[model samples]
Target: MSEPLLSIHDFSVTYDVDPPVHAVKGVTLELARGEILGLAGESGCGKTTLAYGVQRLLKAPAVITNGSVMFHDASGEDVDINALGAEEMRRFRWDKISMVFQGAMNSLNPVAQIGSQLEDVFEVHRPEMTPRQRRSEVADLLELVRVGAQRARSFPHELSGGMRQRVMIAMALALRPQLMVMDEPTTALDVLVQREIIRQISQLRHEFGFSVIFITHDLPLLLEITDRIAIMREGEIVEVGRAEQIWTDPQDAYTRTLLSSFPRLTGERGVVVR
Candidate 1:
């Protein structure tokens, strides 16, 4: 495998309450440069928590109790993400790593134009760029995600669910970060649209040379898109292996169960026999 872009070791997160809830427990995973790593598990299995913890986006009441997140920069510098200060982390995000949040399509500002929202990324991260340059970049980003530049003027509600999802993807790609953490990006979209989004993501990853941590509960979907699959259960990774190996022969009972939970359609195409 190529050099690891991100190395996470002994990571844990907890919600401090009357009795602390250990949301994530000692996760140790690595993402190879330019490779897609799928994190699969049932809902509430700490998949999202791990993503948020890695990015340092967890808020009050939730704390990183242990572990280290090491980001290997392209420049050959190793960054200890857990050690970054507030200002440093603020700048680190969107530049080194970006997140295409779960249901992010629905999270877009309803009143804001798509172009404006896209430009906002540049405004914060690339402030030195001229207004004209930002506008041009925004248009380019939209096109990169297969969303027409003309739709940049449309509000979030004006676009279809798929289009809005594409817009979110465009935003995530705006900075061309080395890594992207996508949490259930295809949720709520129809199967066709979901497939399209997945295809776009794979193509974009190839073209942009960025690594992706694709988090989802769909083991079958992960098998199709990811190079490696890590199965998480109750705040821990139960198994990790090549996608094909995981599908053909999962060592962990939990992984096998997950794969079996999704029914497969066999026999004639376009014909459903109940």
Candidate 2:
């Protein structure tokens, strides 16, 4: 196997409250350079918490008690994510890693045009580029996500839910970061739109060769698209294995229970849709 692009070792996160709640417990995981890893669990199971912790995006009250996140950069430099200062972390984020946050499409500026919103990513990260260049890049990004460049002049409220989601994805892909963490990206969309989004994500990964950490409660969806699936329960990883293995023979009771909770399709088992 190729060396891991990102590594999380003995990671733990705690919510400081009356009798603290341990959100994540000593979770150790790794992402291969160009592989898509799915993080599946029920609501409040710490999937998002773990993702936020890895990127040091957690605020006070939610603290990282222990652990380390190491990034093996393509430039042959190993980055200690936890040790980076404010400025360093800021520079490291979009340039190396980016996140397609849950409800990210809905999070776009309502008054701003779609193109300008995409251009903001370049404005912040690639400030050296001229305004004309940024606009050109924005058009390219929109087209890449399958969102028509004509929509660039439209506002957030003007686009469909899937189109907005695609725009958000385009923004995440703007810098071509090595790894993109997507948390419940398909939520609130209709089944058809959800399938389209998943297809786009899989195609984008193949086209750009960027690693993805897809987090969601949808086990079957993960089974369809991910190379490997990691099942989380109460902040701990109960099972980790190849998507086929997990679908065919899950060792953990929790994993089996999760699989059983969903209705099975007729004919075959362990078949990957993507």
Candidate 3:
């Protein structure tokens, strides 16, 4: 097998409370370089928690109780992300790994123009770039996501939801990170917009050669776009397999349940149930 771009071993996270909720439990998985790995489960199954935990984006009360997240970068350097200090971690984020957060359309700065927000990513990360260069780069990023460059002058509210979503994606791709952690990127959009977002993500992944850790509750979409799928339930990864294998020959009962949850329009219904 190829060297994994990222590897998680026995990872666990817990929310500290009167009765602590174990959010993620001993989940182990691997994401290969330039591959799309989907984390599929029903809502509150710890899918988002796992993604946040791996990226070290968890807030207080959500403690990572165990395990290691090892990231192998293109430079042939292998580092345990858990070991990085705050400054190093800050530098690591966005430049090496970026996230397109869930409900990203809402995440954009409502007060800022799209150009200013996109330019901020470079201003922070690529501070050495001249002002003209930053503007050029921001325009390119907007175009990369298929949003018109003129839309850069528009406020977040001025753009449609789909356009705002595309803007979020463009911002995430600004630094050309080696891996992207996208948490339910298509959530709350219409079916056609969702499909378009998925198509753009897949296209960009292929064109840019970056691996993706795609987190979503939809198994059907995962099967369509990801190379591999990991099914999570109650904070645990109950199944991990090739996308096709998970669809055709699921080993775990929970996997089958998630598969059956999305009904096919044409296929015989009973066939999937059995």
Which candidate would rank higher by lDDT, 1 or 3? 1
Q: What does candidate 2's lDDT look like per residue over 15-112, in tens digits?
A: 99989999999999988999999999999999999999999999989999999999999898999999999999999997789999999989999999
Error of 3 at 272 (Å): 14
Clashes of 1: 0
Report the C-alpha displacement of residue 125, candidate 1, in angstroms. Answer: 0.8
Kindly report which residue stretches of model 2 are placed more than 4 angstroms away from their true locations once superposed: 267-274
> Which candidate should be chosen as best, given lDDT against the real structure?
2
- Candidate 3 residue 222 Cα shift, in angstroms, is 0.8
The TM-score of candidate 2 is 0.96
Give the TM-scores of the predictions, in the order they appear. 0.96, 0.96, 0.96
Looking at model 3, residue 141 earns an lDDT score of: 89
Task: Please give the lDDT score for candidate 2.
Answer: 0.93
Candidate 1 TM-score, true structure as reference: 0.96
- Candidate 3, 196: how far from true, in Å? 1.8
RMSD for all candidates, in order, please: 2.5, 3.7, 2.1
> Candidate 1 on 25-137: residue-level lDDT in tens?
99999899999999999988999999999999999799999999999999999999999999999999989999999989999999999999999999999989999999999
